[model samples]
Target: MKKGSATVAQLSEFDEIIDVRSPAEFADDHIPGAVNMPVLDDAQRARVGTIYKQVSPFEARRIGGALVAENLARHLHAHFQDKPKHWRPLVYCWRGGQRSGAFVTWLRMVGWDACQLEGGYKNFRRMVIDALAQQPATLDFRIIGGATGSAKTRILEALAAAGAQVLDLEGLASHKGSVLGALPGVAQPTQKKFETALHAVLSRFSPDRPVYVEAESRKIGRVHLPTELMEAMRGSPCFAIDASREARIEFLLRDYAYLGDDVADLQRKLGCLNRIISNETLARWQDYAAVHDLPALFTELVDQHYDPLYKRSQNSNYVRFGDAIHVSTDDLSPSGIIAIADAILAKTPVRADAR
Candidate 1:
């Protein structure tokens, strides 16, 4: 096949693909697993762009084309040149235009099949949007709501362990859904990547199995949930697992302390909190953390921060789930966890409510 001619279905079967857009564009969003191999580096891209605007398109290509060829030659030698000759590596530029198309031409000279994505990232993204639009409308969905730090995730883990088919939106998105939600060391994917990951996992779920999801808003970090999933979560039943405030507080610290013992990460994460918290409270929060008064710090955070946001989000615009249940007490105990799961099981059964 010619370069820039392969369809998405064909592209999906490849072992790998290359995206050749600007780094900024890639950072904004992209295919999750794609390795960026921009034929136009940042400096070269700017140079070409300036020429295209200030000089002339012809001069720009004359300059840009040479640089692109050199970069591709280096990529072939240092990286891809020695791989299996027939290896299927789909390549793309922003819109299956000159950049990737050019690379495919060069690759063909080297004896590789070298097909390009028909419409590049633009077309792949459209496929994702269409797939999300087709999410099962009558999914047997259930919410595993809980107070901050109740180890709701742990309970959900147990539920899945006990053979429940769970749809974990947070897990797919790599976020914990709060100011403290950033996982240790791992940067979250862009919205498009998140959507792609979500779709891949969600496709495996059957509408017949009950899927348990954490209560979340449309936005998780930089990514937003699909309209269909958010709507499904809204109409679906929610059951909150209430743990004693103390247990919740301890859990939050344990989960978040890894950011740093230095407290800078906590501050960085709290940049959003400053908008809502009083200036004095924000100052006091840092003060408390500095002195290592961890308990008091987290308590205020739960009351003034996490808990309040949770209540408002879990309440407003969100209809109270008609079918609701609770853990036995406002505390984290194994038995309490069991009771909560049992209650969820009683209310949301696989095959009928959530898939």
Candidate 2:
């Protein structure tokens, strides 16, 4: 790993990295693959921000600087003190400002090889947005879409495992693109980071290979897909993943087990629907959900919201991924999915190039 100031290009060699920005700022956006390890907790950051606004930038820096130093020492002694010798860390704060610089300085003093990112997360975000907005001429895609419980992602994974050139969009995205899509106890990468992650995956696969992705809107939670990729996806051909409502409900429940009695999170994810569904109706649904009315809730959501959107998007963007292989509830198992994929593969040429 390279030591000292780390340029953005140089930072790419690492398999992973740490983000020192406040989690709130990070939740808004951050570098993909960078895990949050905030130097200052939320309260401390708020306190510092207040100081900066009310007092002077100088006073805020003086006070915040001391606090940061203490946090760094604690971090080193506790986490990095006895780890690998001279480890290189890609350090960053918002806009590559004082916070990351402070952390990198402390790392060097402790005999570690620390490289701070130039222009920090902001520059990285710009890079992702630029790449996404103006994707090179060669990029191409094939979208995988089905109703809410169609297991499109599992099929994509199976295809990848089977030596097909594939792009696991959800994996890179840290989202499943639904009310229950978020992984348990893990935060999502920033929107720009998500685009970067998508770009990284897309760049690796041959443009001629039918890159498979789920049909997703421009936004995943707070993150937005890059315009280029979104356009690519919209135009990309698709294989319709079909499944019975019963099977879909089971799959969706298992996938969303993490929410575990947190109906509020579900409502929040549902967004505008909460406004549409009367409180009494919601309470009834929640009660049903509590009593294993999962299929009903899932079916209602698909019928009411997901299905309508999917149909509209598919009807409008049918030109991109031109083929459709419908999957069934009987195809829920791994072999079943593979069979469907193989059946689709058999009908089409292997190296079907896209634009």
Candidate 3:
């Protein structure tokens, strides 16, 4: 790598990664761990673009240059005040263009070893895409299969806590992988950002060690899983959690207790099932929510909707579903889930090749 520029692969060599793109751009997707320090913020970028299109390119640059200088000065006095003289940072903009180039030049003039990303976020994005396409197949995966409310995610969390390799798809997507899975006050990451998160996690995992993940449809909320990963997961061996109906209902009532806080919101979510569930049935479910009769609502949903859908999808999609090792559990509490995770870890000893 040159002293003034670096590639995506050289990300670790820097003391800090700085993205000089606008805040909106940074929010949509960015290199993992990169800090946002916009040379031209959203409004300023829009103003400059308008000028470039309507007035002249030269005029836009003249105005944008002043704004960049002002923002950089503010950043130096405020954000960068504690930085040491030897701090080495990698700076990038959308396309490794004027914004990051100007920022890097100013930093180098300040006697800091600041390099521009060779192709900026565009290059990094390409690397993420390529990694997502190829990396998932390299790992050994174990699917956690179960009906809705089976606490599969909890089991995966327990496995991770017990020092096992686990890929949490739902957590990464910020959705629970159902119509009612949207988390309160939490927005899901953009599809690109989700893919970036996936790449980051997969890069850290050891391929020889079994990576436990929950079974999911191709689409989780709004973002879709990579085709490569979906294919890899379908072909991998599975462990089915055969929790009893009562246990599942109890688990769900506890897990989805948040839904009971706002009866109107809960009814609105239930209204989404109007197409599949009859009007009378939907009205009855809404009434249950209105009355806070969660047990009845969950029981009907499990027996009528989630369980049937899960059965069909698992049988049709997962090649190894029938052959899955059935792990029975009547308890879905934290302690019980931990016990299950421990049993799984003990049963599947790490292979010598994994080490």
Q: lDDT value for candidate 3?
A: 0.92
**Cα lDDT tens digits for candidate 3, 1-355:** 6669999999999999999999999999999999999999999999999999999999999999999999999899888878999999999999899999999999999989999999899999999999999998799988899999889999999999999999999999999998889899899999989999999999999977899999999999999999999999998888889999999999999999999898998999899889998999999999999999999999999999999999888978888888887889999999999988887777664652221
After the best TM-score superposition of candidate 1, give how far the Cα of residue 206 lies from its true spot, in angstroms: 2.5
Pairs with backbone N, CA or C atoms under 3 Å apart (clashes), candidate 1: 139-354, 140-353, 140-354, 140-355, 141-353, 141-354, 208-351, 243-330, 244-330, 244-331
The total number of steric clashes, by the backbone 3 Å criterion, in model 3 comes to 0
Q: Count of backbone clashes for each model?
A: 10, 7, 0
Worst lDDT window (10 residues) for model 1? Answer: 346-355
Please identify which of the two predictions, 1 or 3, would achieve the higher TM-score against the true structure: 3
How close to the true structure is residue 269 of candidate 1, measured as C-alpha lDDT?
68
Rank order (by TM-score, best first): 3, 1, 2
Native-to-model Cα distance after best TM-score fit, residue 281 in candidate 1, in Å = 4.1
- Point to the candidate with the largest lDDT: 3
lDDT of 1 by residue, 1-355 (tens): 5533698777568778778887877777777688888898888899999999999999999999999989988888888856788776788877889998888888777887778888888898898899888884756677777767877776787688777878777787788877778787778887777888887777778877778877777887667888888887787767777778877777667666665475777766666678788889889988776676777888888888778777766766346554556654564556666666666677664444432
User: TM-score for all predictions?
Assistant: 0.85, 0.73, 0.97
What candidate 1 gets wrong by more than 4 Å, as runs, is: 1-4, 136-138, 161-163, 264-283, 329-347, 353-355
Model 3 TM-score (2 dp)? 0.97
TM match of model 1 to true structure:
0.85
